[model samples]
Target: MADAVTEFVLTPEQQDLRRAVRRFCAERLGEDTVRRLAESGTGHDPALWARLGGELGVLGLAVPEELGGAGGGLVDQAVVAEEFGAALVPGPVLGTVGLAVPALVALAGAGLDEDLLASLVEGARTAAFAVPDRGGRFDPALVTVTETGGALTGEVRHVVDGTADVLLVAARTGEEIGLFLTDGGERIPLSTLDRTRRQATVRFSATPARALAVGAGAEQAITAALRVGGALLAAEQVGGAQRMLDRTVAYAGTRLQFGRPIGSFQAVKHRCADMLVLVEHARSTAFHAAWALQDGTDDPDLAVAVAQATCSQAYQQVAQESVQLHGGIGFTWEHAAHLYLKRAVTDAALLGSAAEHRERIAQLVLDGASASGGVRVATG
Candidate 1:
């Protein structure tokens, strides 16, 4: 069997992009700025969104040039996600880059690619995926669709970046399930916990929709796109967990109690050490998944499953420990610890929980590998 994980060596271009995004975040969205952004009632700053999507072209990095993008791949997007995670940058980075762009590129076959990709690349518009309703499951076939000619009627919940420009919604029509681009859905109110990432319910009662092609490879394409998202999200969780661990360590070193730094205490040291272990493992898992996605050489689903499983737990553990280490301030609204905790909790449940991913990993392992390297479920 292959090693539980493999190491990745980044190309010079990939390294450069990672450095650029890291520097940008440090300069433009540092700790103080992140704190203020989280507290701000505006939810997300439109100006920052414009700079990221339009000026930086971050939104279209993964799309192909023929479809109006810089032609960067999932690895590039994962790099950006790391920076966002580190700074806790408040925006639709995951929704737009991770979910929306990939889904659209996969669904908008042939002729539609040019126009749709051009809009996204140019930042003239944005897109979102309306799947994983209130319960937040990726079972696409379960989404209900009432199709009436050019109109689609249904309700999609937990629609990330739903407040954005265009929505690529999943719907079932007759015997086929596919994604459609719609702009006429009525928005339902939602009480969101993460201010940085908004969630909402979309009600489509005869909403006009432009059907996107799903071809014969639709399910595979959608699953591929989602696995990429899952892998990138794992990277984000790893980054976030590292941040939490670093912050807690720094605080422990300086926070004096009984004439010595709190970090000197055995209990605090053990907690921080445990955090390091989880974060390191999560990093390995995420990096493995990223490489698997880029090369398309392994079961992307299994890779993402392992990555997500480790990441969800890593983030939760790191966040909880960071708060506990910080003592009183961590629970206060003025501190940034809670923000990390909130984001970590919300992200843990994204795509699937750690438990769900573990089940998937088991299923993939039990199914074994086909002659062509793809995983296959043994039937009969």
Candidate 2:
């Protein structure tokens, strides 16, 4: 696995691109701007999304060059996600880049809505995809949306970026589940702990729908999109955790106690050291998952599960410690510390929770062990 990760190292050009994205976020996503956007009723700014999609080419990173995309893959997206995570820039990037684009790509055989794909690639239209309930579980039985007679009737809960111009829904069709497309639906914004990243409940009753691709491989395609989404989200968490730890350390150094810097104390030093471990682990796991997904390794599912579980916990813990380490200011709503903390918790629940991932890890390992004649491997 380490060798696989070594092979996936970012090239100089990729590193340069990452720094460019950092600059983009720094210039456009200033602290004041982020605050204003967060406080606003609408979490997304179409103008900002356009600039990122068209100028930065972030939305099209995974699309082919012929499709007006940057012609990159999951690794490139992980890099962009890391910067976005560091900045905590709020928008529909998750659904547009992670879910919508992947779904379109997977369904290319059915002549995926090229117009929709092109619009997304050019950042002309935003999109959202809803799957898995708030419990972070995707079960066909739980899918409330039903398609009948060329119309979709039912509601989708917790649709990521459901406020976009397009909404792709996963619905049960006979014995198999398939993807459905719609122009728009009734979007009910859900009040969340983290307002930076918006989520909404989409209600569709007898709404006209189009089937992009149905029948075989549909389930696998949905899983693939979700796994990659989780991987990119892990990258974001790593960035956030790094920022939180760095800020906490800096604050500890400057904050005086008993006529000396608080960081000089053994307890504070130990906490910082612990935080460093979490940040490093989160980064490594996220990168490993990205590489595994890109390469389509034999155990990509396990890799995603482990990465999601490890990174989510690391970020949440680091966030909690960041708040505690900063003492009083951390508790204030105005502090960026609380923002990261909220984002961490929200991310943890978005796709799945730490405990949920752990359950998956256990199931996958046990099944693999039984199939492999009872040899249990470490969580790798």
The lDDT, on a scale of 0 to 1, for candidate 2 is: 0.82
State the displacement of the C-alpha of residue 2, model 1, in Å, after optimal TM-score superposition.
13
lDDT of each: 0.75, 0.82
Q: How many residue pairs collide in each prediction?
A: 0, 0
Model 1: per-residue Cα lDDT over 239-301, one tens digit each: 889889989999999999999999999998998999999998898778777767766655677
Q: For model 2, give the 10-residue run with minimal summed lDDT.
A: 131-140
Question: Highest TM-score, which number?
Answer: 2
TM-score of each: 0.89, 0.94
Give RMSD to native, each candidate. 4.0, 2.1
Off by over 4 Å in 2: 1-5, 133-137, 371-380
Tens-place lDDT per residue, model 2, 1-380, is: 34554654788978998999999999999777888998787786778888888888887787777766788877888989988999998888788888888778876756378888989987789888876643344566777777887788888877878888888888777666778889767899988888898889999888888887665666666776787788888899999999899899999999999999999999999999999999898888887788777766537767777778988999999999999999999999778998899999999987888888888878778865775478554433
Q: What residue pairs clash in candidate 2, if any at all? A: none
**Against the true structure, whose lDDT is highest?**
2
